[model samples]
Target: MSTVALVTGATQGLGLALVEGLAQRLEPEDTVYLTGRDLDRVGAAVAAMPAGGAQVRGELLDVADPTAAERLAAQLKSRHGGVDVVFGNAVMRVGPDDDPRRIVRDYVEVNNFGTTRLLRAFAPILRDNARLIIVASSLGTLHHLAPSLHDRFDGPGSLDDLDHQVARWRDAVADGSARSGDWPGFVNIPSKIAQVAAVRILAADRRESDSARGILLAAVCPGMINTPTSALWWNVSDAPTPAQAANGLVDLALGPVDPAHYGELVRGGKVLPWSPASGRATVVPYAATTASS
Candidate 1:
């Protein structure tokens, strides 16, 4: 059987490292696609990777574009028949904002809604037992929210439900009515939370149907990486470099699926346990704001 995998937003940082790691593991006939928004960046990323027997290719795939995913899916379907693994790593993390409201909305559109769009477009093309991993954060753990809001997030909710949650956040941030603990004031936290929620819902649905596909869906929080993006919010002296972090992600992308870990937030190859009292996953830097990979 041939191996086919994809990593989105792979022009730099963790995404780039993932592509390189996958390339090392795959055989010559297998293919690993490194995708990003810019063709130039994508080409550069692909060129930089050492050929580890896999066919490393570059493609332009902006998750924010509603149609781009479908177009790529159709193309890949025609050639490879199905996708064995997919790593969603795109984000719209704002530094400083001109219009706070617009920034929040755009952030949701790119970071939250963008994930849903890829799942919708790719669902039809996933091979049996495929791995679908969204690079999320530890902040997604429900303990971060108030007790009243846990049901909306931890329960079975469709993409529409997720959108409703996103809208609620956008409106609240816009109107300056967002409470501190009720919803994280920082937009990245909520966006990552939405991503984790999406994987949980999807994994549950796959289980309910008993499709026998054995798909593994997870929103993974790769522990804080030593990168420029992380430099802004963290002291990265001990943080793993992007290459080191990619090792875990590549394992998830190609390793055996743990039934207990299905539909859960994962880190370091283990299911991230939720403690309402804690409200975040257990990590050295429990509150990481690093965007993208």
Candidate 2:
């Protein structure tokens, strides 16, 4: 049977790029589901692909809706019987300019929730050699926010160490920290902690399932591309269009696979060493960090 793949947030940006890449890599026998919040945009994206001669279709999904992932899974199960690969790429964010707390919450809802939801809803349809690809940002890394109180749950180190820190913020809000337009924000450090924690838990769960014998699960950060949100950090440079990033995503999703690449993060077609001890995802150039702050 030909492979079947589903990519959420496929209207534009990285999601759109992934669709294009999948179009080129997947054979006409395979199927790629392009999804987005807007039906028209999803349709446009599907229409825009180079007709991989494969069965490419559009799915209107708004990951913000708690039931969106489940609904999509149901539709896919009925039409395709099973899905071989799933890319959880939709993300939600707040803040006019990618504020840390705002970004944190948004990432929790879409990135975190979307991942868990899809896995639960589609678990039954996943075949033996299936794959699940998660697109994460380097901002979530402990090294990225090194020396700061940012949370990291995949460890003996997590926001649990800074419980008091969150309490302080809550107290600040309660005591009126924002002086009417001073910008009041709540930092639920636990959320970020949980988001990263989910990654390891999910990977382990799939590995334990007999039904997923050779399934590959991974999380990757496509080098900060020039998406609208990223533009806030620095003038996008050496940035490949979403199209280029999608190529890497597709490679990981369906191009080829080796056991070593599983659970690894790749950039520009190479596996990036991501040990927290060495500040894998955390370390970055001064300019990028400065822009984020």
lDDT of each: 0.79, 0.62
**What's the count of clashing pairs in each model shown?**
3, 2
Q: lDDT, candidate 1, residue 137? A: 90
Scored by Cα lDDT, where does model 1 land? 0.79
Candidate 1: C-alpha RMSD after superposition: 4.1
- For model 2 the local lDDT of residue 291 reads 17
lDDT winner among the candidates?
A: 1
lDDT of 1 by residue, 23-86 (tens): 8888998999999999998988788887567889999999888788889999999999989989
Q: Which parts of model 1 have CA positions greater than 4 angstroms off?
A: 96-102, 179-181, 208-211, 274-293
lDDT of 2: 0.62
The most accurate candidate by TM-score is 1
Query: Across residues 87-187, which tens digit of lDDT does each residue of candidate 2 receive?
Result: 87876644345444335434555655666676567666877788787777544344443333333344423223333343343344344442232122323
